[model samples]
Target: AQTVTQSQPEMSVQEAETVTLSCTYDTSENNYYLFWYKQPPSRQMILVIRQEAYKQQNATENRFSVNFQKAAKSFSLKISDSQLGDTAMYFCAFMKTFMESSGDKLTFGTGTRLAVRP
Candidate 1:
């Protein structure tokens, strides 16, 4: 079974600062996908960023970037120029590519609560 571990239960950052959240996973499959999701107070799960196992290059989206280490099975998220709006519960998810006929379901971590202080 693939499992994601987020050592940090809670974190806080000042507005306009940068914060990096750590995530590690264990998966036997050679090809899989990793993702970082942010859930705000509204309780909507939003995709922060994603990385394909086959791709050595990390993925970045605006202020969010990932440090993907395939060999170590680690995927970390870096939030730059953070704001009060960035405060939320961040979850790291793992997905294995099943047959096209199969359903798509995401396996998520326990999540890290991020509090951005003004």
Candidate 2:
């Protein structure tokens, strides 16, 4: 069984500041993938960052980055110079690399509501 957990239910940061969202997961699978998704007011889930279990290096994109700890089963997202547009609901997701069937899907956490204050 696999489960994702986001400890922070809500977080606020001033614009241009940096904020780190905490996430942890429990999984028995050796090969898997972790992802951070952002869902804005439009209610569309967008992929922010992704980390492969086998990769030692953390994943980063622009101002968005992730601190992936494979051994500790933790994957946290760090947003630098946060902008107002970054305000959204962040979700942590997990997916097994080996899919037994087409029905395989990702397991998501409760989510963290991030408000980028002006």
Candidate 3:
């Protein structure tokens, strides 16, 4: 089993700026990986990024990026040029490598509530 932790329960960032949310995880297995998810007021959880354990390079998507330190078991998300629409509850999640049909066991962190201020 894997466990993810988000240290900050709440964070605020100004619009058009940058913000990074910190996350840490514990796992005994080596093949499992990490993911960042964003849930807005609409109550939909969106996949922000994915990082495989063996990958040396961090995963990135548009304005979102991750600082993945496999040695330290840390994965943090960096949001560049933040926007009002980015205000949401961000979660750090973990999943073991499994067949897509078998179903994924995702362990989610408590989540960090982020607010994008104007």
Candidate 4:
């Protein structure tokens, strides 16, 4: 099993600014995928960005981007042009490329609470 860690528990950012959340993981698996998920006040989960272990390119979705360092097992989420609506709990998750008997399951970090202030 892999374990993800988010060092910062809480952070506040001004609207229209930028913020970065740090994440690191310990894993022995070779083929895997890393992801960042956002959960707002309503509890709806959203996929921020995804990075593949085999791919060297970082993944970005809109204002959300990830800085993935495979060798260091580090994956950080960077929000550009942050908005008030971006306030939420951000989780760093990991998944293996292949499915296991129990099905593909995601191992998640404790999470970082992001509050965007107007």
lDDT of 3 at 61: 96
lDDT (10s digit) by residue, model 2, range 1-118: 8999999999999999999999999988988999999999999999999999999999989999999989899999999999999999999999989555654589999999999999
Question: Which residue pairs in candidate 2 have backbone atoms (N, alpha carbon, C) closer than 3 angstroms, thus clashing?
Answer: none
Residue 83, model 4: lDDT of 94
Model 3 spans > 4 angstroms off: none
For candidate 3, the per-residue lDDT at 32 reads 75
- In model 2, the worst 10-residue window by lDDT is 96-105
List, residue by residue over 1-118, the lDDT tens digit for candidate 4.
7899999999999999999999999999998999899999899999888898999989888998989899999999999999988999999999988665656789999999999999
lDDT by residue (tens digit), candidate 3, 1-118: 6788999999999999999999999998787779999999999999999999988999999999999998899999999999999999999999987676896879999999999999
> Candidate 3, residue 73: CA error in Å?
0.3
Instruction: Tell me the deviation in Å of residue 22 in model 4.
Output: 0.4
For candidate 2, what's the RMSD? 1.3
TM-score of each candidate? Answer: 0.96, 0.95, 0.95, 0.94
Order by lDDT, highest first: 2, 3, 1, 4
* Tens digits of lDDT, candidate 1, 46-113: 98998989999999999999999999889999999999999999999999975688855788999999
Worst 10 residues of 4 by lDDT: 96-105
| lDDT of predicted model 3 | 0.94
Clashes in each model (backbone N, CA, C under 3 Å)? 0, 0, 0, 0
lDDT on C-alpha atoms for all candidate structures = 0.93, 0.94, 0.94, 0.92
